[model samples]
Structure formats: C-alpha cells, structure tokens
Target: MNTIFLLNKTKDPTLSEWYERKINDELRALGIKDVHCKAVSSEPMALEITHPLVLICSSSILRDTYSYQSAEQVYAPHAKILAIIVHEKVKFFRHRFTNLQFSPLRFIYNPHRMPLRELIFHLLSQLDIDLEVRR
Candidate 1:
C-alpha cells in the first residue's frame, strides 16, 4: 500500500484540521485507504520523510514561510512533491519548483473552495494508481 502524507503549513490549526478531515473524508468517499496526514510547522521536514507517501502541500508554501527552501530541498533528484495552488494565485508558481530532479512533480489547482471530491479525483488521477489498485 502506498502511504500518502498531507502536510499543511497554514498558521491556523483550525484550517489544518479542516483540511485533514476534508481530504481524508474525500479519500474515503473514493474508497481509498492507507492515506494519512501529518502537519509540519517547520522546514527541512522533507529530509525526514520517506518515499511511497506522496506529499500534499498547501498554498501557504508559495509564500515566504518555509515555501522556497522546503520546495527546493524536497525537489531532490528523487523527490516527489504535489502542490495544490489556487488559480488566482498562479503567479506564485513561477520558477518555484524548477530544480526538481526526479519524476515530474504533480500539481492541481482548484478555486481552493472547490468540493473535496474534485480535488481528490485530480490528485488520484495524477498518481496514475487509483484506489482500486491499492485494494
């Protein structure tokens, strides 16, 4: 089973909780298991995480807070990072994740207010292995 990690750097704990619940809930609705979350408030976390668990980052990482360095370090020749960006905030994606030396990182942009199912489908399709594969 592939382990998926949900990492959010948002300052608000409430938002973190909401995101976890929403993402996990949607994953369940899609019949996906082995998906989980671990919130991190600091950079360099990429160094500690193992592979097979896709990293799901929040929009806050595009800003000055732990965004650049985290993205850089995680962009190792073998690292995989998926960024969820809001379309209105597309400007932030510029030259941000360029140094990634591994398989192409995945990205899915919604209104940030779209239904959880929409984001879940987009995420699953990118991995190329759906819930059925895990089962």
Candidate 2:
C-alpha cells in the first residue's frame, strides 16, 4: 500500500479542501487502490503516522522556525516531502531553496497555476511510482 499525506497548514479551508479532493481523485484515477491519503492540519498527528510516506505540505505551515524543524525531524530520511510555496512567479522559490535541510525534497510553487495532472505526475515521480489505470 502507498501512503500520501497532505499536511495542510493553510488558514484557508477552501484551498485545503480542494487540494485533498483533487489529489485523492487523481490517485483513484491512476488505479492506486491500496493508497491511503489524508489532509491533516496538525503536525503531531502527521508525525505519529508510521509508513513510507509521500508528504505535501504548504510553506505557510513551515514559516515558523519550530514548525519547520518539527517537519524536518518527522519526515526527513523517511518520506519524499514536497513543500509548496505560493508566489507570483515560480522562480522566486529558488531563492529560498537553500534553507531547507531535508533530503528527498521537492518544491511546488504556485500550484494553482499548474495543471493537476502535472502536479500529480511530479509527486509520483519523486516517489518513483508508476501508475496504470484500468478504466
């Protein structure tokens, strides 16, 4: 079974809900039947989950130093973590990339501007997962 954890720390409930529903829908479309995915608001709750995980978290959640460290400690070395930062231009994220310490990490800037399939493919690629849907 594959586990995908979406740590939504965004204050906007609407955006968080969209991410959860869209991501899960795409997973289902790809025939990931044994996949377990969830959107969690709390860091401690996410940390307690024991599985080889793929984590997608908003940068707003990690803006606080403690929150970022907690995330690094929890998901580092075990999961493929993707940090999303909303910006006007995707290139802006490059300036901030040096600060992160986590390995197996990827970045998604201005996710709203990207196609859902593209985003899903990027996440699956990071985990080296190939999905085949039987429609």
Of the candidates shown, which would achieve the greatest TM-score relative to the real structure? 2
Clashes of each: 0, 0
- For all candidates in order, the CA lDDT equals 0.49, 0.54
Instruction: Please provide TM-scores, in order, for all candidate models, with all chains considered together.
Output: 0.53, 0.58
Candidate 1, residue 98: Cα displacement in angstroms equals 17
> Ten consecutive residues with minimal summed lDDT in candidate 2?
97-106
- Residues 65-114, model 2: lDDT tens digits: 53445445645434436554342233334555433433334344365455
lDDT of 1 by residue, 1-135 (tens): 554455444444455456667777777766777655444443466446664233444454445544335443544323455544333334545665522322233444445435556656655665676446332
Task: Write down the TM-score for model 2.
Answer: 0.58
User: Could you tell me which residue pairs clash in candidate 2?
Assistant: none
Give residue 69's error in model 1 in angstroms: 11
Candidate achieving the largest lDDT: 2
